[model samples]
Target: MTSSGFEALLEAVRGPASVNVLVITGAGISLASGIPTFRGTDPGAVWSNEVMEKGTHAFFQRAPHESWKMYLQRFELARAAKPNAAHRALVAWEAWQEAQGRGFAVVTQNVDSLHEDAGSRQLVKVHGSLRLARCSAQGCELGAPRGTVPMASVDFSAFHASPSPETVPRCPRCDSRLRPHVLWFDENYTEHDTYEIERTLILARQSRVIVFVGTSFSVGVTELVYRRGRKLDARMFSIDPSNASLDRGIEPVTARAEEALPELVRVLQS
Candidate 1:
């Protein structure tokens, strides 16, 4: 927990009394909360790798009912999960930084609301949120941030295995099938959100140091955060259980994010 490396990195940035944005990605941070990463092997999934690769687009085209059921099944899983220690650490860091006339802008590739649930401010959810659903109909009357009757206040009971032959849910607004608002395999990201995320990365680059937590840094969106930090000559610290392909020439703290982040916050607070 006593990382002299993080201590030195903190000393370099704590002197500046301004917002210090921290860019992060999905994998390691959410593990403590029970969310699995791409390579992660959870007990088992309602949908397998094959189903996911086929995705909503393919399923809806060939088997509409099946796709809708899969979407609902995933939604229920996410709803049941709670925020974890790594998420709380980020929120605490932001609070402490704010007290010191500084702030944090967190841009994450996570679809889950763990960061928001952890009380982080100045957030950018680049991949959208799992809690939200929208009409699948293109340019349909249904819009962003879609709302619906509360699904029984989602809880532990909802994590049951998905029933076979997926059933589709409908949008009350337009009677169109409802779908998760998250980005999919064959889809492009939202331009507005992408621009805002890039803007935060630019700020993190100019920062004295950039801290990466739990991310593999394989995806372009997450990789850019580290790349920008390097461009600005910012000190870099990466926290993950294992080193990534992107770990070359960077200091790697080979530990889980849950273990590392709270410790980092404690040292940084001093």
Candidate 2:
């Protein structure tokens, strides 16, 4: 791991009056979490290309049990992964800012709650969380919080025993199929989620500086943070080894988040 550009950018952004908000993206931050990279040159992703292309909607339509199995596998991996140095640094930064009468916001694209585990005060989980499950029954309003333990108890081998088979998870309340409470690829983002994001964006705009940590800013929702931050006239910094498809006007800091964030924290603390 090398030094991060975000750290250097953070140094420039720290000031007396203006609030500092940090919007984190996917891939770059999760590198320490042991999750496989999707876009880059990695070839050994556990899921097939069809699964990657289709996501939950396609899988659930075909084989619901298999979909659940795949989801659980990923969930198990994320659950085992602990919060890295970068995550702890952000949490510390947030604490420091809040203590000094400033604000700090952490908006993450990754569904894993590593930031939450690190005790981050302000967070926006844009992709939704895998640690929860919702009822699949039509007009179902109740959501069941299925954490790591419930998910691990699922008998995936028994569920995928037949061809054209669908495994419907029992809802704790209504006994309907338990749907993973993640925002699928084709589904529209929930209005509630959008509202929270919009509020965070407004807060970010008010900040004097915005940092894009451990993200490439490639995808739609993730990229919007960078675009909006730039529009607000806030100084921007990105930390990634690769700057592929970076939009104009944002400074690219070619480095990993783990190395960069701790160093940045040290500088800020000193």
lDDT for every model? 0.64, 0.66
What RMSD value applies to candidate 2? 3.7
By TM-score, the best candidate is 2
Question: What's the TM-score of each model vs. the native?
Answer: 0.78, 0.83
Query: Scored by Cα lDDT, where does model 2 land?
Result: 0.66
lDDT of 2 by residue, 99-144 (tens): 7788788877777878899998788876677776666655555442
Candidate 1 lDDT over 152-227, as tens digits, reads: 3332122335433234556676876666566665554542243255566666765665667776665566667766
Worst 10 residues of 2 by lDDT: 144-153
Question: What residue runs in model 1 are displaced by over 4 Å at the alpha carbon?
Answer: 3-5, 41-48, 144-167, 191-208, 244-249
Clashes per candidate, residues 3 or more apart or on different chains? 0, 0
